[model samples]
Target: MLSPVSTDSNHHPLNGTDATEHSVGADLPRAIATLNEEETYRALLTATHWATLDHAYGSAAEAPKRLAELLAQDQTVRTKALDYLHYTLHHQNTLYEATAPAALYVAAILPNPRTTRTVDKGHNSFPGCMRAELLLWIASVADAVTDEADVLSRRHGFPLDDYPPAVSIRRIRPQLYSAAVAYVDDTDRPTAEAAITACIRLLDDPRLLHHRAALVPGIRQILGTSEQWQHRERAIDALDTWGEDSTGLEGQQNPFLFCDSDTPTDNGSRPIDTNEGYSEPPPF
Candidate 1:
């Protein structure tokens, strides 16, 4: 069930800055802080808005509902919400107009500290892996929207005026990238690893390249301290691929070579290739 859109003016605060010029780390939270969840949901999920948007299965009216489900208390419900998002918005590695809006909500939900905490005896109930999966989905949606916008620009010699949602996606990309970078040190291994993966995927965007200085320390920390070999390997790969200077680390002979060939690594199970359009296989 979708939450009712709040009509109160106080609930719909605006950050009062140009989205384009906003700084990364400070901008995402600021923009999110100003948003009214219900109002935003209402604006993005209406029939008039969704009538034009088409997902793999067709109409994307359910996107907002699924997005709302992400905030549900049950971990299973949250996981299903992510799965539905992947199936609909990003099915077959394809992006839809609804993808960007959905990505925004995903970014909004991620900053909550409870989302990344391990299940504990106290108030925290959501599983950390659910947050990790959401990070993967954010990266996938961001990558897909970027690819779509680039393709349109190359073909038309201008921005995507034909698709207004694509423009929104491009505009919000910096904030999305910032949110991912900010969460790189989340205490849970899965959440931190997924955050790193999102950062690596986002490097493909020129707007986020400037964030390299901000992202390096977290990547380095993950490479040096994370218990999961997958997290460490991905961080090392990101550093090497980006040519980031890892000189801050103490004496080490090619820290990049720390991972032996025999060590198994999980190449993030999600299928998020920009060039590939393969549909997900059946679970059987």
Candidate 2:
């Protein structure tokens, strides 16, 4: 099969030898020839499709449009493209990683996270080839970017209090966190807090259990805090919802959820039933 022609390689310009190597291109004959083969064609096209999106090329919008056209007709291409997107978003190389500037386009064209999960399940070939990896990739990047912004806020002396309260933080927070987290494949202790927060959100929908296991430390910390008895129990309840075996701490079998979700009753053991009684959980 014909592989991706490096748009970065020198093309024999009609004028002469000194033309700068770049991503500008006409569709290569090799890519065209493979289109009839379905799977191979989809993989090849999706892998190289970003070439057309390069600003170094003349038509910026046209590349993604052509990609959408290919996606509409071929399920394989769409699956491959989405996975490719996750790869690009997470990879650390500045030349390849998705940039913050692309947020507008990402929001417009990317598949919804919830819907993307279903599409991921549709692509599996076997057990080890599970679909959760890509979704985790997305979540990772979103978390990373969010963390970076927090660092920036602290480093530059921007007060967290200055952030507008009415703004929907979750909507903006995930994309930032996702960008940063995408590059992290192995879980780290620092990010456990963010990962746990993400896992809880996913818990309302049970299917996330399989995927959430990797983030167990953060969840355990959330469940084990000692702020108050009731708050601690709620954390336990959340863990219980996931079931006893759901706890995956490194040393502990029945991991304790922390006191972050504290109740404000006299003993902190009682549920804070009234809005007046309970302090709100921090902005997720």
Candidate 3:
């Protein structure tokens, strides 16, 4: 099989969760007021023919079921199903035919906190709600369609277009950006950071350029403190691209700050980490 262009290597996570740490990020319920979470999820699911979509593997027919499991009453089921979706939707940052719609589903379900039971799902040591990880995955998908990535994909004979199992995921930038921007003010810092990263790349849609400045403050915030270098780096690039001054911002906080060994750390006392670097997982 021919390898296509890997546009953005900016954001990602994994398929497994460390059993020891289970930290939750900001309260999602507060972000969403009075919305019927269950009804909303069902409505979104009913409109899509998931069986006709495609992922890194095969048909996305199983996607709807896996996504519905996000609301499962069982913790193990929720986390495991989340992991499965991540693995299938974005294997190694190579977006598949099914990636876009699946991503839309993830974005659609953001308002519900009942689906957030996993932690340490991102490549960073950041402890957050499962929503944060989902946002980060969106970022990774958008990252795969950046200008540089497009050049590489073309050179590699993949062309990053709305074609087969190769590059169809590149054309839906505007829609994805629209869905992701809804959480830019999320109470969860990681989630907000992930959403910001996603919106920055998806802004490739010329129509969204005017909104770039609005996202600056969040980008600055990410650069100021995020443990994930990939997120921080993207923020810096975005600032430069948009002509925003990113003066004193650094690439990463001291991962060693108040830590022992090289294992890295998480939200204050938690010490939660996936031990993965900036690259990704089978689902990046």
Candidate 4:
């Protein structure tokens, strides 16, 4: 396992327990604040860093602004943010120094209720579907990192040091994991499905797969219910993939094996929309 990166005295590592006990959304501001102070993060924010870092559009100068705009209240703004992220950070499955932090920011914002609210009263807003898309993008980036790392290790004939971007992600795995779990239970079907997809893709990383026991129950819950047909199918697909590689889980009542793809309802009825008590994102 990689050693935890050292942070200042005021900043604490976001372990699984802290994530469980506290709201991941509530903790995002502090996490971003702490990240801002890290040397590598600070470098990524600089104009010089953007000028030197290559992206699909030649330079990554817009990366920092786009990262900040991901928190914007406007649906258009957030969509643009996703576009910029997709075009630059991991364009064509290429990772950069900024890719990891970009992914971290994506994970940090996932559970923020402010980012998940649908548009209302003509105010610009983020939709649950968009948030779900962002989660999918996050999953893609994580999978790309694993693929790239493996290729490099094989070619170099030695285990490479943790890629800088991945190291940044490792520093906050607990927070990401916590947010993902919270998202899986989100009232919006697409958002929840997206979260499940993210969780499944993240399992591609060996470190995360090693901790699969903690996440398996949640995966089972999704697969065993009628939350959303598409979500359930995605969950089943992810579990099936993981089951193939996971020898330990063999003969342990694989949830995917018994899942009914054609039937939307399982032992329980379809989940009711329970948006009550949830606040909409405040207008900009």
What would the per-residue lDDT of candidate 4 be over residues 1-284, giving only the tens digit for each residue? Answer: 12112222222222223333332222443454444343434342442344555555566667778876766778678766765666567654555666654665676555455566442211232334557667666666655545445677658774324455444454444445545655766667666655666666555555456655555665666533534554455556556656732222323244565533222122111111123311222112
Off by over 4 Å in 3: 1-40, 120-127, 162-171, 252-284
- Cα lDDT of candidate 2 equals 0.33
Candidate 2 matches the true fold with a TM-score of: 0.29
Better of 3 and 4 by lDDT: 3
Per-residue CA lDDT of candidate 1, range 1-284, in tens?
Answer: 11111111121111224433322222345555644555643443342245556677778766777777766777667656665777677674455667765676677667654465332111223334657777777766555455544776768775554555555565666656666766676666667767777766666666666666667777787654566556566676667767876554433345576643222224443433233322345222
TM-scores vs. true structure, each candidate: 0.62, 0.29, 0.70, 0.56
Ordered from best to worst TM-score, the candidate numbers read: 3, 1, 4, 2
- Specify the poorest-scoring 10-residue window by lDDT in model 2: 1-10
How accurate locally is residue 283 in candidate 2, as Cα lDDT from 0 to 100?
21
> Who is ahead in TM-score, 1 or 2?
1
State which candidate has the highest lDDT: 3
Give all candidates' CA lDDT scores. 0.57, 0.33, 0.58, 0.50
Error of 4 at 152 (Å): 11
Q: Over the stretch 1-284, how does candidate 3's per-residue lDDT look in tens digits? A: 11111122121111113312212101122212333556656645555556777776678888878888876777667766666655567665556767765665675576666745665443443435777666666676777777767778889887766444333345445545655787777766766776777777777656567777777887897534577565566667778887889887776566454533223222111222244632233332
- TM-score of candidate 1 against the unseen true structure: 0.62
